[model samples]
Target: MDKRLFKEWESCVKCGICRSVCPVFKEEKSEPYVARGHITLLSELIKGNIDFSEKEAKDYLYKCLLCTTCVESCPNDSHTDTIVEIARHEVIKKHGLPTYKKILSKLLKSRQAMDFAFKSASTFSPIFAKKNNKPRDGIKLRIEVAGKDRLLPPIAKQTFLDKYGNDKKSRVVLFPGCLINYTYTEIGDAFVNILKKLKIDFSVPKKQLCCGAPIYFAGNFEDARYLAEKNIELFLSLNAEHIVVLEPTCASMIKLDYPKLFMYFEDKKWEEKARRVAEKIIDPIKFLFDQTDVLRRLKKLPIRTTYHDPCHLKRALKVKDEPREFLKAISDYTEMKEADRCCGNGGTFSIDYRETSLKIASRKVKNILDTKSEYLATSCSACIMQLADILNLKDHKEIKVYHLLELIDKALEA
Candidate 1:
């Protein structure tokens, strides 16, 4: 961790100005859990005045959604995400990770383990999916996680890479991320189809692992760094001109987080390679828009859709307009109020703080419902999962949630 960055981040005024813009604080109604409050605690830790073993400091770091909203809204332009990340790194270094997080990080770093997990999820999906009485009930089903209801999309019968394996098209490498490869392979299929339609050559790297966003958020920086090194080596071997990633979180990790984390890599060439590879990182929706002929072809879908900008994509990476423009080219695109507001699925935050996460997602669902559009399109898989669950719990079945690439693929098919 950079001590200078950590020190500057500790100087937040605790002004509460960011409270109104923070989705987590808005939902939880807790000042200590907000960005300003987290910075205050981090300041204490930085000063060596607080210990990580204390529940107050530990909970303060863990409670943050890491949505980056406060940073975006900060009058001083303080980088809150980096502050939280450094605090998290410090906490993990002191107290170590939880059992589940250790297991998750291990699975994430191992390609074989991830493949097996996806295969198992696809195998057992029918056990969780049941028939219901609504119009889209057959298409959607619920799963219970830690006593909270979650609406899970059925796993695709064939995984994305399996169907597209061995095809050497345009020579680009695909990063499907955990959720897309395991639960929502159809999104991956849509990405592949869109790339194919555009005649962009791409390949799915056989040894791809998790992009490490989950592990990074879980305060396991050691494992996260390991996964980053592994992915950097693998992508370097592929020699693709660009890395097309379907998940915004994964793309953000490769494009932004990794470079920051590996700034002082052992091999100067490795650092250079990682930076060069990061330059080619493109979200699937943005990649599709860059194809002019494809954009012209996409101007034909006749459906009404609204976009929800994922906080990571919109704020962390400043990619708010690309997905919107891509959707506009395909459909009657409507911008919902608070389009940049978070959907409250801050990876493990949704799992650890269920009630708070649900409250945040409820606001997002309300915003989408206000638009009254048929579909709510977003670029992040986790956001899609949380939004779908929130809408289902409200019994709003008419509103469909799709990845931006999925909508684009539908338009091309039409």
Candidate 2:
């Protein structure tokens, strides 16, 4: 019942407009799974009209994907996603986080822990991970976890961070999140290749850690803030003009969540640093697209492709046109149905709520299939992972899933 979030909850007015656009509601067909229902529940709790046990509140709060569909469609422009985040923080503060979240928080809170876990996974990957090295697919390894296959972009022998140190001459700082640094190093490489092509001098900060999106969404706000502060300090020390991220979710987290996270604290100093860092955060596609002559250098690719809008890329950042405009310039770009719909891969959401995540992702796969395109492209690494999993598990391997950066790099080579 934080006052700021309570105010946002009060603004809902029980309108069902968010229900129409919510991907979870479409799959669950339950009021509890939609934004309106959550707002009503929060309103009731704050007004003393309803009572929920600690477990009950946790249930309602954790069910959300925080994809911002309702936030985008609300008539009053209610901040549903931020409200949901605060609600989760409140619940976790009262009842404590689930075991999985505790583990995730520990790993994400420290770069050393993340590196150790990834390196250990890489050592055992050959036995546990299956390779998918196709040109268009971002899923590099399909590893068996708890008897179910979990998708991961392959880890590099030499991490991007390990390969490059602080460069005083660079104008840009590349913040490779855990995925790009450990799991999908090729995406990091693709980014590096594209930066070289653009003649943009960028440095990969060796001290950069996880973007804390996972921990923040899972209600571990304290740890997320600590990570954010560490990142903010690290990047500011680099004295770079622009801070670029390989993953759209990372960019969204740094740009949006970092400032919001700082709001809960009385310390104004960190908020100022977060705001400065936020101002420098840029999406790679949007940054590259600004270089008009570089776009003209891309060869016309002959392959037919369609785009899947990552929720963070589209809803969080309002980046609907930049990636598309870039794709249309170099390839036969086809628009998929409900391109901006959530693919239900809210990082840990897919792992915690597999059935619902899969159901939503299946529909997205169907939309991709309907376009009859050879490849499906998106800007977020999480969306790429989920779409690749749903596409493969559903026996639609003929269609490859790719990051927009990957395609851009390929077009440069072509």
Clashes per candidate, residues 3 or more apart or on different chains = 6, 0
In candidate 2, what residue range of length 10 has the lowest lDDT sum?
138-147
Shift of residue 178 alpha carbon in model 1, Å: 1.4
Measured with C-alpha atoms, the lDDT of residue 287 in candidate 1 is 69
lDDT of each residue in 185-212, candidate 1, tens digit only: 8889888787777776778876677899
TM-score of each: 0.91, 0.93
CA lDDT for candidate 1: 0.75
The residue pairs that clash in candidate 2, if any, are none
**lDDT (0 to 1) per candidate:** 0.75, 0.79
Model 1 reaches what TM-score against the true structure?
A: 0.91
What TM-score would candidate 2 get against the native? 0.93
Give candidate 2's error at residue 253 in angstroms. 1.0
